[model samples]
Every structure is written in C-alpha cells, then in structure tokens.
Target: MPQHRNISCHLYIGDTKAMEYNVHNVDNRSTAHIVSEEGQTFSFKIEAGTALMSAARLDLELWADGYKLDCFTFTESVYEVDDAQVRDQVTGAIKIVKLRFAKLNTVDQGPSNADDAEAEQLKRLGTLEIKLWRSESNVSQSTTFPYADCPLQTPIHEKKIKGQSVSHVTSLESKGTVAQQSSWGYITTKIDPYDRPWVAFVFKHASKALLQSEGIVPKDEVKEKGAAVASAKGKKAQSSRAKVNDTKNEESKVEDVKFDDDVAAMSQPQLRQEIMRLRKRPGDSLDQSVVKARRTMKCVRTPDADNLLSTAEKGDKRK
Candidate 1:
C-alpha cells in the first residue's frame, strides 16, 4: 500500500480576547502575513494530506502584544488516509497538529521618527497557547492547547543595591561636584595604598578650590601617576625576591657538593679495608681486585736511581 503524506504550518499572533483589546489599540497588532528575509510575501494553502504527513516538520512564528514570541518547531506527525481499508484500520489516528507561542504584550506605538530610542510599550495582556492533533475526516480536529501568560512588567529598570545611597545631580553645580567626588574616590581605591589617600586629598581640595574659583574642573592625572608608581614598586619587590631565591639556590648547590666530598673522604679508608677483606674471600673477589689494581696502578719514580741502575747492570752481567 502506498502511504500518503501531508504537511501544514500556521503562525498565529493574538487570541480572541487579546485581539479584542489589540483592535481597540489599533497600533499594537501586526497584520497576518508571511514575511521573508527580503520583505517578500509568502502565501500557500496546506493540503489535508500534506498537513497530516509532514505537519511535525513545520516551523511556526508567533508575534503578539508588543514583543515577538519565540518560534516553535513541531515534532508530531499528522496523517490523512483516503483508502477505505486503511482509514477503517486506523480510525482514531491523529492527523492535524498546531503550535502556538506566548504573546508579547508590548508593541512599538511611538511615532516613526522616534526610531530605536523609543521604549516598547504593552498594548494588551494575554496568554498564548499551542495546539497539536490529527483529524480523521474533513472535520476540524479538537485538541486542548497549553498556554503561558506574558509578563506585563518592563524587562529593564534602574536598580539600586540594598544599603547603597542614591545620589542624583539635577544642576550643573551639583553634577560637577558629584563628578569630582566620584573621580577622587576612584583614584583613592584603585591606586597604590601609599599614594592613594594623598593624591585623593590633593585632588579633592583642588576640585573644591576650582569649584570656588571660576567653576573649573580638575583633571585625573594624579590618579594615573599613583597607579604607575604602585606598579613600579610591585615589580621591584618581585625582582628582589627572585634575586634572593637565586642566591639561596646557588648556596644550596655548593653545600651539596661539599657534603658529598666530605662523605667520600670519610668513607675512603673503610672502602679500602672492605676491598681487602673481599680479596681474602675464597672466590673471584681476589682475582678481580688483582685485575683492577693492575689496571689502576702506575709505576712510581724511585729516589735511589743509582742503586736501581747498579742492580740492573748486575742482572745484565749475570744474564
């Protein structure tokens, strides 16, 4: 038997209730249309057979309220069988599937000239539901859909940490004072400890004096110099420590060699005695010593050269 295949996908924005509210606020709802990347229109009707066989492979786009909902990809197969025998056998099989995403409550309602700077505002509030099922005949399949409510609160807000003091600058004088204080604190905390407070005090006084004078602002050059000085001191300390470690390592190596020489000198007599005792043993030790000594020893020059010459001459005459 040849199996029939069908696929269909639909993108839904707002529900009936949300749509009612959106229509009243005409600017919030997006018109129903498939928009391609290049601003092209895509319109196609899904056949029953195609929707049944390949609905699971379709991708859905959902937009509602002010924000665009996340896109959902279907995974359930829907099938419509025309063969009487096959239909009778699989009478209760699901044939249609649909997916709906959460609705966005906010839509841009400001004038076109506002551009991207305008904050998105919510036009209506509602939950979004997605439904998936199969239809046996031409009748629409009834399935319960699951939905999630769209949160109405703004996503971004100015937040202050607990236990922090809030400071506001409303006038030029207040803004200048706040900026000077902030720069002074930044310099004190970020620079070297030795120079931090001194530089901060100098800048703070200079800032105050400038505020009293023609309302001028002091620069942050002192903070920069303090940081540079601290960094140089740290490098110097690190290098000095490294030099000390190198000296210690050299001394340790010298001590190790001296210890080894002392040990060898102390053990020399004992080593020789041990070798002699091994030579007296009844095995190959004595033979090995004779070979070793012969290889190692050299002839010594005698001070009695005349006696050595006379003995050699006599031996020659006798021979």
Candidate 2:
C-alpha cells in the first residue's frame, strides 16, 4: 500500500468567517477530517476506486470565534481536466461544482439573486463549453468564452461556433457589424434629416396655436391689421400718381376736369360708356384704348355662344 499525505486548506465562508479541513492518508485513498470550534469533529473517507473521485462526502462548519455555525453535508465528485474520453461526465461534474459553490457562497448571505454574476464568472473562467443543439436536425453549436469578457451588459461581441448552416455565419457576422456601428460611443444625441423639417413645423404651429388658445391675440386680428396696412399703402400710391398727373396738366396749361372722384364713383356700366367715348375721341388710337380697357376690366363673363364659336373656329383652323 502506498502512503498518502493529508492536504490541509483554509477557505472563507461568507464574508466574516473561515473554514479549515484536513485530508488524511489511507490505503491508496484519502479521508477528510473537519473540526469545529464547538468541540465538534466529522470524518469521511475518499476511496481510490478510479483515477478521479467519482463521489465525495464533506462535513462543513464555520471556524470563526463566538459564532455558532450550522453543520451541513455536501456530496461531490472530482474529474480530470483534459479527460476527453469522459467529456460528458466531466461536464456534468463541473456543473455540480458550480452549483455547489453557488449554494455554499449564498448559504449565509441570503439568496444569490445574481444570475448574471455567476454566468459572467463562468464565462471569464473559460473552463467549459456551453452548447445549443437542434433535436430535429441533430445539429449542435458550441461557444467557449473567457470569464472576464463575459457579457456584463448586452451581449455584443462573443465567439460562437455553429455545427450547421453556412448562412448562419453570414447572418451573425452582419448582425454583429451593424451592432458595432450603432453602439453608443460617447454620442448622446442624433438628428434625423427626414424628421427635422416636420418637427420644426410642428413646433412652430404648436407655439402659435398655444398663444392663440391662451387669448394672447387671435391670428384673424393680425391678418386684418396687415390688410389695413396694405390698403393704406395702395391709397398713398394712388394719390401720388394723381398728383403727378395733375402737375402735368398744369404745365400744359389745360383745364383739367376733376375726374378722379368721378372715376372712383363710376359703376361698371358707366365706366364702359366712358371708355367707348374715349375711344371715339379724335387723335385716340382705338386699338390702344381697347387694350387698356380690357386690362382694367374685372370679372368679364363672355357668352357661351361666343366661346363655342371661338372653339369651332380654332378647330376649323387646326383641321
């Protein structure tokens, strides 16, 4: 029989306490001895049935002074790191180890509601490969990651291996590129050109409507005030033109009639009669008078018969 040496180690349990244990040498095997400060001792033997410890039993307690610790039994197994022959078995063993550590760490600290924390730690440690498999197609994909680079925020960049379609690689790569391009890199604001014009218009209209709704002043009143200003300008222009015409008449030594008020008061029929009389006067060009009269006319309603005759003549000329 080969002699085995006990391996002793100390570990911290929770935040304020520590645990101590000793492994005793046996017949090509080892036994763990755990001692508590309250004069308590527990013993368990590990048999060397296989190269790796398939099953283990442990007695755990706190070693801190003045604190009463609860006793618990934990069953575990050890596995070789590079045992490809029993990869599934090792994977299951590693999962057990992870669960045990999580339970032990949270025993005194209440519930470890940090799902992301454990996942991130596992990712950083980089000891295991997690996979997603499709049952119908019998295809599988696996990803191995480093513990520190695990996604603490959204999963942006992580290595992935796929067992099936080539299209999946292209899709994932394209998605990753788009994600990287759109990531928030010290930029807090973005302006969209398509939305700017409409947004500005909406803001201006909203402000104007709010002012009117609050009884500040109605838009109708502003429009009426603008029309009054335009009317004043038109009256000033007409008066200036009449003064120039009056000066011209005075320089020619002609007795000019006071026709400004008469023209202003004349209705449509009387204006047409005056235009005919002016056209019939001596030295007046009838063609020029007719053009001027046509230019000054308002709302001329031509006979439908005349319109039809004009259209018929135009069609005849075209034919």
Candidate 3:
C-alpha cells in the first residue's frame, strides 16, 4: 500500500507571525466545487491610507510532521516589484499566487539499510523554494509564479485498459496550467483531522461605499451619508438652475429693447446687419422682428376695412 502523509502550509507577511493551514491533495472530481467556492469568495477591505507594513511583505512555508519543508518569500521591495496599486475599491488590484509541490524519491546509493529506506519513504516529498517576479511584456498581464518548467514526474495505475484485464500505467501529475490546475494549490486547514482545501489571500483597497456594498460596512451609516450628499447636491443644483433662468430672462428682455431701437434709428442695410447678428447669437428669438422688418422694407401695408367699405358705398350711390 502507498504511504500517505499530512502537509500543512503557513503564510507570513513581513515581520508578522505566521498563519498556518493544513495542505490538501484535492481529488479531480472535487475541482468544480472548489472553483465555485473561490468565485463566491469575498475579501476583507482595508481603508485607503491605512498603513499596513505587513501587507507589503509575503512569505509562505510548508511543513510536515512539525518540520518545515518549503519556504517561499516575497519580502524584498514588494511595492516596487509588483503593481498592486489599490486606488479605490477593494477589488481594484488583486494578486493571486499559487505554489505547487512535488514529490522526490530518495535515490538508492551503494547499499541502503532498512532504517534508511523507511526514513526515505517517510520524507519522500521534496522541499520547494520560490521567489516572486513580475511580467510586464503583455497587454493582458498578471503576477505569475513560474513552477511549470520544473515538475516532478510520477506514474499511477489507470483503471481502464483497452480490452485488457490488467490495469495500465498512466501519469498522475499537473503541468501547472489553468486547465490542468484551476485551484491555488489545496491545503487542509481544518481541526477535525481531515484534509480540506483553502484558497489564498487577496490584497485590495476598500472605501466606505465599497465596503458597504460588499456588506463589510454598516448599511445604515452608508444610507444616511448617501442621503445627505444627495440632498445637498439637489439643493445646489436647483439654486444654480434658478440663477441661470433669471439671467436668461433679463438678457432676452435687453435683446428685444436693443433690437427695436436699432431698427428705428438705423438704415435698411444696418437693420439687416442687426438681424444677421441676432441670428448668429444662439438661443435668441427674432421671428416677429424679422417679419415686421421685411414687410416695412417691401412697403407692403393692408388698408383699414372701414375706409374701404365707406369708399365702396359712396361709389355705389354715385352709380
């Protein structure tokens, strides 16, 4: 029978104490559930300008049987290395780093004793040390931990064999691709002595409104503040609009008086020029003035109906 061991992972940020969690070897069938959980997972928000020196440095360590096995560090100039600039919402700048582990068998030298062989079997898995690096070559970019180039190859038994009674040998390993490994390497962080998977941490900025929207901030406080802001904005907008309307009314009255005086004092050419100038001024109405000016220029006038009737009656009596 194959021997199994429990592995635990711990995370450290800067000089802060390490946060430990158990590591899990997730089955392929349970990957969908893991992905769903990660998708629905929300993070705690840190307010803007909140100085947290620990967030700048990150370290991850893996241990087995209370012995430290692997250590991954990102403590050197973290802010300068990555573009984790959190401007507004907590979801603005998200960094996800996955650490993959591999098993290495102990090579047999000269003559291996029974005790040595047992010890090697117990410590079969090898340690992995990682240092983070940034990639800025592509338009669609991300912070990547390159562990795919070095993979520990191993083989497992395949259940289905083509028309054969015996099981066939097949490989059981990940190539560190999104399709091959959709999770941020699993860890068993439970207290019930069972293996469970846990997703990694996310770092981002959080404002009052953003926190309230994500249910991190109190809803009542956000609502009251939002209402106050809206009320103040509405009053300011109304006052500005009223001032604009009054200015427009006064300007319109002044324009009408000016136009009437210009037509009475100026020649036909000057009146036409004034009309053209008024037409060029946007939002100025000169329909009545233009029509009256055109009629006077043409010397066209309608006689009074009373005078015309009196003249027609006198002509009829004479006839």
Top model number, lDDT: 3
* lDDT of candidate 1 over 1-319, digit per residue (tens): 1112222322212221111111111221212211111111111122234553522243333333233333233334432211110001133221221222221122344332322423332211121212123322222222432222322333222221122211111010011111121111101111112211111000011112333243333335787799999999999999999999999999988975664444344333443443444445576664575443233221222233334334433544575
- Residue 217's lDDT within candidate 1 is 32
lDDT of 3 by residue, 1-319 (tens): 0001211222222223222122223331110000101111111111212112323323333332112223333333322111111111232222232322222223433433336543442332222111222212222222342232222232312211112221111112222323333223323222222222122221121233433455543567677999999999999999999999999999988975675565566654454455455444577565654454454433322233234334433554576
What is the TM-score of each predicted model, taking all chains together?
A: 0.19, 0.14, 0.20
Error of 1 at 301 (Å): 24
User: Which parts of model 1 have CA positions greater than 4 angstroms off?
Assistant: 1-219, 269-319
> What's the lDDT for all of these models?
0.29, 0.29, 0.32
TM-score, cand. 2: 0.14
Model 1, residue 299: what's the lDDT? 21
Return model 1's CA RMSD, one decimal: 30.9
Which residues of candidate 3, in runs, are more than 4 Å off?
Answer: 1-219, 266-319
Candidate 3 accuracy as TM-score: 0.20
Clashing pairs counted in every model: 18, 6, 4
